[model samples]
Target: MLWVKAFHILFVVSWFSGLFYLPRIFVNLALEKESVSRERLLLMARKLYRFMMMLSVPAVLLGAWLLWLQYGGSGSFKMPGWMHAKLTLVILAIGYSHACGAILKKFERGANTRSHTWYRWFNEVPVLMLLAIIILVVVKPF
Candidate 1:
C-alpha cells in the first residue's frame, strides 16, 4: 500500500507538470503569428498532450487501486466525504485534460478563435484544481 501510494503521488505529480505547462504552450500558440513558430508550438502541444495522457493513465489507475484497497473487499464503503470531493475534482481534472486535447485539435485545424487571454485564464484551472485536491486530501475538510 505504501508503495502504491508513493507511485500514485509520483505519477500524479508527473501528470500535473504537463497539465501546468500545456496551457502555457496554448497561450504561446494563441499569440504566435509566424507560421513556422505556430507549427512548432503545435508540434510541442501534440507531443505534450500525448505524454500527459500517458502519465494520466497510470495516475488514475493507481488512484483507483488505492481506493479499492482502502474501500474494497467488504463492499461496505464508509469513505470520507473529503474523498468524494477529491474524486470529483479528479474527474474534473481528467475532463480538463481532454478539453485541452480538444483545444489542441482546434488549434490544429486553424479553428481556434480564442485569444491568448482566454488561454491564460484557462491555464489557471488546473492550478486551482490541484489546490483544492491537495486541501481535500491533506486537510480533509468536510
Candidate 2:
C-alpha cells in the first residue's frame, strides 16, 4: 500500500506534466498550416497523448485501487467532505485528459484544422482543471 501511494504520487506528477504540455502542443498545431510542420506538431501531440494513456491511466487506476482498499465499504477508513471534493476534482481531471486525447486522435488523423480560438479555449480546460486539482490537494475545500 505504501508502494502504491509512492508510485501514485510520482506518476501523477508525470501525468500532470503531460497534461500541461499537451495543450501547448495543440496551440502550436493550431498556429501552423497543414504542412510538414503540422506533421511535426501532430507527432508531438500523439506522443504526449500516448504517454498519458500509458502512464497516467495506470497511475490513476492504482490510486483508485488504493482508495478502494482504504475506504471502499470499510469502516476502518472514513472519507470527509474535503476528500469528496478532492475526488470530484480528480474525476474532472481525468475527463479533461480524455478530451485532450480525443483531440489528439483527431489531429493525428489530419482532421479539420483547429482555429487558434479553439486551441486557446482548449488550453484553458487543462489549466483550469489543474488549478482545481491543486486546490483539491492543497486547500482541500470542504
How many clashes does each candidate structure show, in the order listed? 0, 0
lDDT of 1 by residue, 1-142 (tens): 9999999999999999999999999999999989999999999999999999999999999999999999886699779999999999999999999999999999999999999999999999999999999999999888
Top-TM-score candidate index: 1
Assess the local accuracy of residue 76 in candidate 2 as a C-alpha lDDT between 0 and 100.
67
C-alpha RMSD (angstroms) for model 2: 2.4
- Superposition error at 128 for model 1 (Å): 0.4
**Candidate 2 error regions (>4 Å):** 73-78
lDDT string, candidate 2, 18-83, tens digits? 888898888887778768999888877887888876887777898887888778856667887877
TM-score of each: 0.98, 0.82
**Model 1 alpha-carbon drift over 4 Å, by segment:** none
| Backbone-clash count (model 1) | 0
What lDDT score is found at residue 10 in candidate 1? 97
Candidate 2 clashes between residue pairs 3 or more apart in a chain or in different chains = none
